[model samples]
Target: MTVRPASVDDLPAIADIYAHYVATSVATFELDVPDRDEWQRRHAAIAAARLPFVVTERDGAVAGYAYCAPWKARPAYRATVEDSVYVAPSAVGTGCGAELLPALLDMSRAVGVRQVIAVIADSGDEASVRLHRRFGFRDAGRLERVGYKHDRWIDTVLMQWSA
Candidate 1:
C-alpha cells in the first residue's frame, strides 16, 4: 500500500467510502451524502488552509482517505484541527487506516498544527477509538446523546493528540 497527498481525481472514491459509512453506520452524523460539488468545495477549503488531505492506494486504487480541517473558525483555534478517516469496506483490515492516519498526522505537524482532535461517533464499534489510541491519542471526553441518527440517539467520543 502507498500513501500520498490526495488530488481532485480521488474525491469520487473518497466520497464513496464516506457514503458507505453515512448510509450504513452512525460513524458520521451526516444524514445525506454530500455531492461531488460539495466534495470539491471541501477539498478546496482544506487546500486553501494548507492542511493535509491524503489517500492510501492499494493496487492503484484508493483504499482509504484522511484529512484535517480547522476545529473552529475562530482565530484562537487556528492551530487546532479535527481529523476524519475512512476506509473502503474491502480495505478495513488491510491496514489502510493505519497508513492514512499517521501520514495525516505527520503532515499536520509539518504544517504547524499544534493539536489534533478526533470527534468520533460512539457507534458501538470501538475500532475507531482503538485506532486513535494506538496512535497516541488520549481520551478527552464524551458527549452523551448529542447526535440523533438512524432512528437512534448517539454519542461522540472526543480524543486528542498534541504535538
Candidate 2:
C-alpha cells in the first residue's frame, strides 16, 4: 500500500468509505451520507487550514483515509487536533488504518501539531479504540450517552496522543 496526501480526485472514494460507516455503524456520528460536494468542502476546509489529509492506495484504489483538524474552534486549542479515519469495507482488517494514521501523525507533527485526539463515537468500538492506542494514544475520558444514533445511546471515547 502507498500512503500519500489526498487530492481532489480522492474525495469520491473518501465519501463512499465514510458513507458506509455513517449508514452501518456507530463508529461515526454522522446520520446521513454526505455527497461529493460536501466531501469536497470538508477536504477544502482542512486544506485551507494547511492541515494534512491522507489517503491510502492499494492496487490503484483508495483503501482508507485519515485527517486531523483543529480540536476546537478556540485558538487556545490550536496545538491540538481531532483525527478522523475510515477504511473501505474490504480493507478493514488489512492494516489500512495502521498505514494511514502514522502518516497523518507524522504530517501533523511536521506541521507543528502537538496533540492528536480521537473522539470515537461508540465506546465499544474496540477496533478504532485499539487503532489509536496502537499509535500511542491513551484513554483520555468518556462522555456517557453523548449521542443518540441508530436508535441507540452511545458514549464518546476520547483518546489522545501527545508529542
Candidate 3:
C-alpha cells in the first residue's frame, strides 16, 4: 500500500467511498450524496486553497483517502485544521486508514498546522474513535444530538490531536 497526494483522477473513487458513508452511515452529517460535479468542485476548491488531500492505494486501487483543511474560516483557526478520512468498505481493517492517517498528520505538520481535529459521528463509531485515539487524538467534547439521519438523532464527538 502507498499513500500519496490525491488528484482529479482520484475523485471518482473518493466520491464512491464518501457516498457509501452518506447513504449507510452517520459518519458525515450530510444527508444527500453529492454528484460527481459537486464532488469535483469541492476537491478543486480544497486544492486551490493549497490544502493537503491524500489517498492510499492498495493493489493498484484507491483503498482510502485522508485530507486536512482549515478548521474554521476565522483567522484564529488558521493554525488548526480539521481532518477527514474515508476507506472503501472492502478496505476496512486492511491498514488503509493506518497508512493514510499518518500521511495527513505529517502533511499538517509540514504545513505548520498546530492542531488536528476529528469530528466523529458518534461514540458508537469505535473504529474512527479508536483510530484517532491511537494517533494521539483526545476527546475534546461531545455535541449531543447534533445530527439527524436514518430516522434518529446522532451525537457528534469532537476529538483533537496536537501537533
Candidate 4:
C-alpha cells in the first residue's frame, strides 16, 4: 500500500468511506451523510489551509483516508489539531489505517503542529483505541454521553499525543 496527500480527485472516494461510516455505524457522529459536493467544499477549505489530508492506496484503489483539522477556531489553538481516520470497512484490520495514521502524524509535525488529538467514538472500538495508543496518544479523558447515534447515547474518548 502507498500513502499520499489527498487531492481533489480523491474526495469522492473519501466521501464514500465516510458515508458508509455515517450510515451504518456509530463510529462517527454525523447523523446525515453529506453529498459529494459538500464534501468537496469542505475538503477544498482544508486543502486551501494546507492541512494534512492523506489517502492510503492499495493496488491503485483508495483503501482508507486520514486527516487532521484544527481543534478549535482561535489562533491560540493553532498548534493543536484533531485527527480523523476512516478505513473502508473491507480494509479495516489489514494495516491500511496503520499506514495512514503515521503519515498523517508526520505531516502534522512537518507543518509545526505541536499536539495531535483523536476523539474516539466509544469504548466498544477497542482496536481503534489501541491503534491510537500504539502511536503514543494517551487517554486524556472521556465525555460521557456526549453523542447520540444508532438509537443510543455514546461517549467520546479524548486521546492526545504531543509531537
Candidate 5:
C-alpha cells in the first residue's frame, strides 16, 4: 500500500467512502452525504491553506484517507491542527488509518505544526480511539451527549498530541 497527497481525481472515491459513514454510522455526525462538488470545495480549502490531505491505496484502490486542518481560525491556533482519518469499510482492520495518520503527523511536524487534535464523534468508537491512542494521542476532553445521531444522543471524544 502507498500513501500520497490527494488530488481532485480522488474526491469521488473519498466522497463514497465518507458517505457510508454518514449514512450508516455515527463516526461522523453529518446527516447528508456531501456531493463531489462539496468535496472539491473542501479540497480547495485545504490546498489554499497548504494543509496536508493524503490518501492510501491498496491494490490500486483507495483504501483510506486522512488530513490535517487548522485547529481554529485564530492566528494563535496556527501551530495546532485537527486531524481526520477514515478507512474504507473493505479495508478496516488493515491498519489503514494507523498508517495514514502518522504520515499526516509527520507532514504536520515538518510544516512546523506543534500539535495535533482528534475530535472523534463517538466515545464508543474503539477503533478510532485506539488508533489515535496508539499514535500517542491522549484524552484531552469529552463532551457528553454533544451530538445526536442515529436517533440517539452521542458523546464526542477529544484526543490530542503535542510536540
Candidate 6:
C-alpha cells in the first residue's frame, strides 16, 4: 500500500468509504451521505486552507483516507485542527489507517499545526481509539450522549495530540 495526497479523482472512493460508515455504523454521526459535489467543495476548502488531505492506495485503488480541518471557525483555533480518518471496509485490517494517519499528522505538523484533536464516536469499536493512542494521542475528554443517530444516543471521545 502507498500513502499520498488525495486528488479530485479520489473523492468518489473517499465518499464511498465515508458513506458506508454513515449508513451502517455510528462511527460518524452524519445522517446523510455527502455527494461528490460536496466532497469536491470540501477538498477545495481543505486545499485552500493548505491543510493535509491524503489517501492510501492498494493495487491502484483508494483504500482509505485521512485529513485535518480547522477544529473551529474562530481565529483563536487557527493553530489547532481536528482529524478524520476512514478506511475502506475491505481494507480495514490491511494497515491502511496505520499508513494514512501518520502521514496526515506529519504533514499537519509541517504546515504549522500545533495540536490535533480527534472527535471519535463511541460506537463500541475500540480500534479507532487504539489507533489514535498508538500515534501519541491521549484521552482528552468525552461528551456523554452528545449525538443521537440510528435511533440511539451516542457519546463522543475526544482525543488530543500535541506537536
**What ranges in model 2 sit over 4 Å off?**
none
Task: Encode model 6's per-residue lDDT on 4-30: one tens digit a residue.
Answer: 999999999999999999999999998
For residues 33-121, what per-residue lDDT tens digits would candidate 1 score against the true structure? 99999999999999999999999998999999999999999999999999999999998898988998899999999999999999999
TM-score per candidate, chains pooled: 0.99, 0.97, 0.96, 0.97, 0.96, 0.99
Which scores higher on lDDT, 2 or 5?
A: 2
lDDT of each: 0.95, 0.92, 0.90, 0.90, 0.91, 0.96
Order of quality (lDDT)? 6, 1, 2, 5, 4, 3
Residue 86 in candidate 1, Cα distance off native in Å? 0.2
- Where model 3 places Cα greater than 4 Å from the true spot, the runs are none
Q: Model 3, range 74-157, lDDT digits (tens) per residue?
A: 998888989999999999999988888888998888888899999988837599999998888999999999889999999988
Among residues 3 or more apart in sequence or in different chains, the pairs in candidate 6 whose N, CA or C atoms overlap within 3 Å are none
**TM-score of model 5 (CA atoms):** 0.96
Q: Give residue 162's lDDT in candidate 1 (0 to 100).
A: 95
TM-score of 3: 0.96
Better of 1 and 4 by lDDT: 1
True-vs-predicted CA distance for residue 157, candidate 5, Å: 1.0
Name the weakest run of 10 consecutive residues (lDDT summed) in model 4. Answer: 42-51
List pairs with backbone clashes in candidate 2: none
lDDT for residue 127 in candidate 3, whole number 0-100:
95
lDDT of 2 at 11: 91
